[model samples]
Target: GYNSHSVLSILMQTYMDSSTVLAPVPSFWGLVNSAWNLCAIGKRQSPIDIETTHMIFDPHLTPLRLNTGGRKMYGTMYNTGKHVSLRPDKTHLVNISGGPLGYSYRLEEVRLHFGSEDALGSEHLLNGQGFPGEVRCKT
Candidate 1:
């Protein structure tokens, strides 16, 4: 029997190895591992294309508030072979409120994605255009 941690460890180890030839593609991620089933079949996934013309602006929307306690943040960055990730230290409390959010949310992790070329890096596309890099913040 395999646990979630073990499965993650195996996935991480396999992904970290550049020489591995059996790496699964995006469409096959869920088929190869039960833990990643959502990757293959999930209806609501991330990194979707954003069409600016479809965006609606609401004047009632308030400005988002970021509370950092006026202190510098410290975090450890890691290169996971696929992307760069930053996990903030627990001692650094960063929170965000207002805007469209109903409650205050704490900062969790940040991910950066880039490619060797200028037109091939971003995870999300804007008007069918890709950028050199993209930064994603997860909370």
Candidate 2:
């Protein structure tokens, strides 16, 4: 299977060689909102440190369920320069529900990101450490 991020990065590198150089790609440290002076602001920004001691267990919460209905999903990979985004086929959507969600939500797009090395590329850090990679799914 192809790693979308890797493919996108290669595409971006090729583009960079031909076009006028662009600013740094939007990343976990500097997102599009602040970089472009956009009005949208993230209230709950990521890459925060989540300590296990601060977590609370809720016994009543149901486990999250992902129902694809046995249908095959097709999508295209995009090289946004900042990230490798996935645009799914509008016809077949994945249904995700449960846990604290009140209704099932359909997946929109999925973005994948990774570090230059295997040890440091996660948007969310647990106790101040990065993971090998991360998948940012939009729903």
Candidate 3:
């Protein structure tokens, strides 16, 4: 659930500081192209009928933690960076619900960062939706 731009904004305190990080995960057009490609991959015909996904943003008012696996993740890591090294976060619980769309989670800590490379890149897809090479992490 680290994709909260609002929280990122708060953690950053300003957009000026935000740019120092990286580009937005998944360029909008990239996912569109990927979706179309994936949809046609196993299809019997040329163009295929694919279901589309929409971007949804909501206010993140709750704070949570990570799980046991997440804790072990933090236990073994490298602390070499210009900033404070963030580790695998434990999951904490939230009373609020994801309202059928999302699942309520807890805040244990923060799992460093994982992807093919950096924040601008990741290893998963949103139901096969890939706007760009970059992505967000939420589990």
Q: After superposition, how far is residue 44 of candidate 3 from its true place, in Å?
A: 25
TM-score winner between 1 and 3, please give it: 1
**Whole-model alpha-carbon lDDT for candidate 1:** 0.62
How would you encode candidate 3's per-residue C-alpha lDDT over 1-139 as one tens digit per residue? 3342222111110111231333222223235456335333443531122233453343764443323433234322453442223334333222222332133333222233232432322223333332223212222
How displaced is residue 101 in candidate 2, in Å?
A: 1.8
Worst 10 residues of 2 by lDDT: 8-17
lDDT per residue, candidate 1, 69-123, as tens digits?
A: 8988888999998789998888987765567444566666677877787656677
Backbone clash count for every predicted candidate, in the order shown = 0, 0, 24
lDDT of each: 0.62, 0.56, 0.29
| Residue-by-residue lDDT tens digits, candidate 2, 33-101 | 344232134455344555556655768899877677898878889978766888778777776567744
Model 3's number of clashes is 24
Ordered from best to worst lDDT, the candidate numbers read 1, 2, 3
Look at candidate 3 and tell me the lDDT of residue 50.
23
